[model samples]
Target chain A: MNVFKLNSWSPYVAGGMVGILICLSVLITGKYFGASTTFVRSAGLIEKVFAPERVEKMDYFVKKKVRIDWQWMFVVGVFFGSLLSSRISGDYRKTALPPMWETRFGPNRARRWVIAFVGGIIAMFGARMAGG
Target chain B: MNLLFWGLVTGIFFGFLLQKGQVLRYDKQLGALRLSDFTIVKFMLSTVIVAMVGIYFLHDFGLVALKPKTTALGANIIGGLIFGAGWGLLGYCPATAVGALGEGRWDSLFGIIGMLFGAAIYAEVYPALKTNVLAWGNLGKITLPGVLGINHWIVIVVLIIAFCSLFYWFEKKGV
Candidate 1:
């Protein structure tokens, strides 16, 4: 009956819920669930600000044809939805670093940010290379 | 029905599930990457099984079409390696990072920002990257059934059973 812990559900149940969501998505829209596409589109949108023609002619953007699409909105919804869930369950709390992170990586905020940024760059590079 | 509406609605449910499933938890994520925790893997395997079966059923009913992404051996292996490294380092994916941000883990923001910049970098040099890396071992759209030349149902059933057995074993091992 712990309000704070109520946010945590059995992995199986949560996984099932995700499955159901995916099922509904495909059943209704003929699209699979993905989030990386939003970042790509966001990047494309930003690129248009500086080099409009380059972005316009880029084969990647040409194929994707960037605008705020369902994926971007969907990702935004995920953020808000998570906030709502956490708020309702009393699990929402501001923390600069999770305990595990501090214990493993030490309490160096700058280092954490640098590693995360570099990792993200490498990861996204791979994602696009894989056409994700 | 507009697809955007569907995306918004489903995205909410998806976020809720990710939060509840503890996939947004840093410890759980790190453990999974380190092979010390099977919880996330079980969750992901269950999701794949469900989606595989459910999507096939929907397709059979003529309610949807299955458009599996193209499989490129080079792309998958290379991308998977980098993604795995990043996951091990940041302990978050694009989806789970959003969930964690909602839960108020500010550090997750760094990873998110990095992801955005990374995406920008990829977009900037996409033409060259596409030609050199993306074209490697390119295999047109494919699926398990197509690769194995078996019925989708058969693959689904087999994978379901296999995953269930693995799940049971993992639970017993308590890793």
Candidate 2:
């Protein structure tokens, strides 16, 4: 049997599969799915490791400081899942940057770096305001 | 063993699908924005329908606990708009960005990092905004079936028809 490559599935097909996966998640675990929480938790862990006082005082970080394993496992699963998908599809490429990005953003890499940092800040701010 | 675990698993699966759909590609996402490719719309529509149906059933059966009622209508709409803009700019949402990064696309790393930063900022500033910015409106859990006074099943059927018609129209338009 031929397995479908990462790019082989049509959008609808892949979406439906994802939808089913969502259903499975609900059935098996009974929770809504999200990604930002993992990152927030990781940030908490970083703070805990280097600056315990900061982690303890910050309301946002404090809540996530406990039970670090659960969030870490989930984050690890996501990272590995993506890696496995890429490997199986024969589409894995290891580089700090893509060629098109380098060409478009320029050789300094400063533009991309600055945009990413600002963008990350804005995204996290929005999530917290929304109570996520 | 509980809902949180399932949530994580579901997230990982969504990451996988994002990779499979090539949605992590900047070109594909940009193409969708241009209306040259209907992939994003199609995919989102299908997923929303599935989620809606699932939620409806779960509520109907008392299989899951619903969130306590909150009436932050202004926040929901504003947050949704901001999120949509971010999605367009980044070419990937929080979930897919992880998958993209997993595929070794450095740009996705930026996207994920951006999301984390955004969430953190929100947390720090939420108290100040909660009173003013979040108090613009208070429409609590408005649903089509509730507003229309129709049976849940009927509402679901109507939505299915409407979505299918939209899909057909888009297909006809050669998108």
Q: Can you list each candidate's DockQ?
A: 0.71, 0.46
Highest lDDT: give the candidate number: 1
Query: How many clashing pairs in candidate 2?
Result: 10
Candidate 1 lDDT, tens digit per residue, A19-75? Answer: 878888877777688888888888888889999988888887787778887888788
Candidate 2 residue lDDT tens string, B72-96:
7677667766665666656666666
Q: What TM-score does chain B of candidate 2 reach?
A: 0.82
Residue A45, candidate 1: alpha-carbon lDDT: 89
lDDT of each: 0.81, 0.66
The reply for model 2, stretches above 4 Å from the true place, is: A61-75, A94-109, B1-9, B58-62, B65-71
CA lDDT for candidate 1 = 0.81
Checking candidate 1 for backbone clashes, the offending pairs are none
Candidate 1 per-residue lDDT, tens place, B63-125, comes to: 988877888778788888887787677778888888889889878888888888888877777
| Candidate 1 TM-score to native | 0.94
